[model samples]
Target: MSRLIRGVGAVLLAGAVLGGCATHPNSEQALQQAGGDFQKVKEDANVLRFAPKDVIRAGESLARADRLSTYWGSGADVEHYAYLSRRYSAIAREHTEQGLNAERGARLELERQRLQLALRESKLSSVQQQGKWLEEQITSLATQTDRGLVMTLGDVLFDTGDAELKNSANRTVLKIVQFLQLNPKRVVRIEGYADNTGGEQENLRLSRDRAQSVADVLVDLGIDEKRIQVEGYGDQYPVEANASERGRAQNRRVEIVFSDAKGQLGAAR
Candidate 1:
């Protein structure tokens, strides 16, 4: 392809210039003699490419060419391969230098990529280990009976004056989501309780509203409404003494009670 040929020409031209730029002449005469040799060979009829014998000829030509190119602006008539001969030799010298530089760059780039891959693999392994440990913790929590979970929620789920689930109760909400999603056939109950600190009618209304709020959140989190029921346990079924702050806090909470209709998880047959 013409494109490929052009690309090759560009690379060769670059090598010649770069090679000459880096080379230092040991003696002025030696450099001039090499340049003179290239000048004489510029008239040669053969277009020799790079072979072992050709390399020797090219070297001889490059030295002379180098000398002639130095005198280009001195008003000498530009002969047809005079510039060619000089340029070609310079190109040959540049090729050697560029090849060495390219090899060194390739080696360093490969080393950098290897180190980067190693670091990424190490971090990925650590994250996978942490995920496994978290799964184990979830599994342990899943093995507990629903009543134990509800009892736990009673203490830590709400504050003394609030029916809102505490921040510490976030894990419970997540676990409930997981459980409901997994047991798609099971129905759940939301039972809200309030302490006797408020008036009887207000307490009942608050309990019902709070229970409805819990059910609303569950539904928003993808639980099916047909599988859930909400109820208010108003000032009744007290788990602890209403006189104490701790007991009142315990009483003011929501319970996610599982009532399996399909009995899928050993609750049926």
Candidate 2:
């Protein structure tokens, strides 16, 4: 009976030793992982700046886990503290990323506003010089007609069959935007026309799309939509015969008709 009791005691002791052995490696691994995480957050400048308290807590917990790892039968406690350390480190990293993103967004917004202001000031500073040049250019590009002062945007400003205005049109568009800004009370009607090669309905749709595209750009550049009117004349009023490519090119055009100084516009065709 004594031998049986001794055998049972020895088996129980071995089982306990095996259980401790199983937990030991896991606890050591947890501690190493936690230490690595804590070290990374401690070294990161942004993490320190954004989450100093969380980083400090992570370091404290890692230290406690490291100390507990040296004691016997403290595997569970070591792993618990290590988990806490890793969680704190993860939280610190997350907070740092969020803070950095917010800072970046704010900086970008400030840069955008500053650039806009600089552009406005630059335009204002050169207004007199630009105004003289713009007047001469406008006089050359426009004519005094019964429809008021009409400026023509030729087919060269857009691709064949496309409603989009090309980058080459930037100079003329900018001049118009500046002109309208200078004459605040003056409004303009943008009329689009297409050659008669396509079907009538298709020409009408393309012409309208082209006109709307111009108006969209003007609005994007700070022009009020209410101050601008858009119209599509299609292939009805051709300035040149469409028998040749050159003449067709001439027929496909956009016309900007400016209102008088009193904001009175002529009749639309």
Candidate 3:
């Protein structure tokens, strides 16, 4: 009879311990809600790719909540852990959104830079075409020479022993003025030469006076004076021998040299 009584007492003690360890319904519900939220966020593509660490932390919080409910039953500690799990899930979602927004901003900036570069290229092409048209106009009036494009006015254009130009040379002067007006960026150099028939001093003075006469005409035609350079090369740099009248005639002339686009003139060959 004493053995039976002792066994009943042991059974009562075991039941009491089991009842103390059992979880309350409210604690179980809280754990389920936290776990569901974490799972839902973790499955999202952005969160999985960009916020993987945050999502992992949320899952760990949920596991901790579950352990607390199993060991301590319905308690404040379980609820606290459940709240932490839900907060971590929210943080993961927020980080994912921030990362996506940053990526979109970077793409927009790159597109803006591309458009600016294209616009600059278009403007440069237009400028190059305009320069080509100006070149064509110059070619019509001048002949290409070793030094650059040159326009020559023979001794017939000027009076003998005088620096004044003849009336017949008006057309040539007009064409030159029109070209200069069209291309304001171009620079002109007026060079004068004389035949060997004259004395050295007299020939040099005459050549210089003729070059100055042409320079004055250009300035009067609305071309800037700064764009013209004048020089006299008496009986020097002759194109033909002075032994014949024809050769001497060719040597006594004025040459207008046009520089390249950058205002650079090549040396005479």
Best by lDDT: 2
What lDDT does model 1 reach? 0.60
lDDT of 3 by residue, 1-269 (tens): 99999998876565445432344556667777898989889789988988898898889888887777655444566777888998999999899999998999899889889989999999878766765665675587679988899988875776546677777777888777776766677788998888887788888888788888888988988889988988888778888998988888777778899887677766643
Candidate 1, number of clashes: 8
RMSD of each: 15.4, 14.8, 9.8
lDDT on C-alpha atoms for all candidate structures: 0.60, 0.87, 0.79
Q: What is the TM-score of each candidate against the true structure?
A: 0.42, 0.52, 0.49
Give residue 45's error in model 3 in angstroms.
Answer: 1.8
C-alpha RMSD (angstroms) for model 2: 14.8
Clashes of each: 8, 0, 0
Best TM-score among the predictions, by candidate number: 2
Looking at candidate 1, the ten consecutive residues that score lowest on lDDT are 72-81
- Residue-by-residue lDDT tens digits, candidate 1, 77-138: 22322344455555554554565577789999999999999999999787666655644554
Tens-place lDDT per residue, model 2, 172-196, is: 8888888888778889999999999
Error of 3 at 36 (Å): 4.6
Instruction: Return the candidate ranking by TM-score, descending.
Output: 2, 3, 1
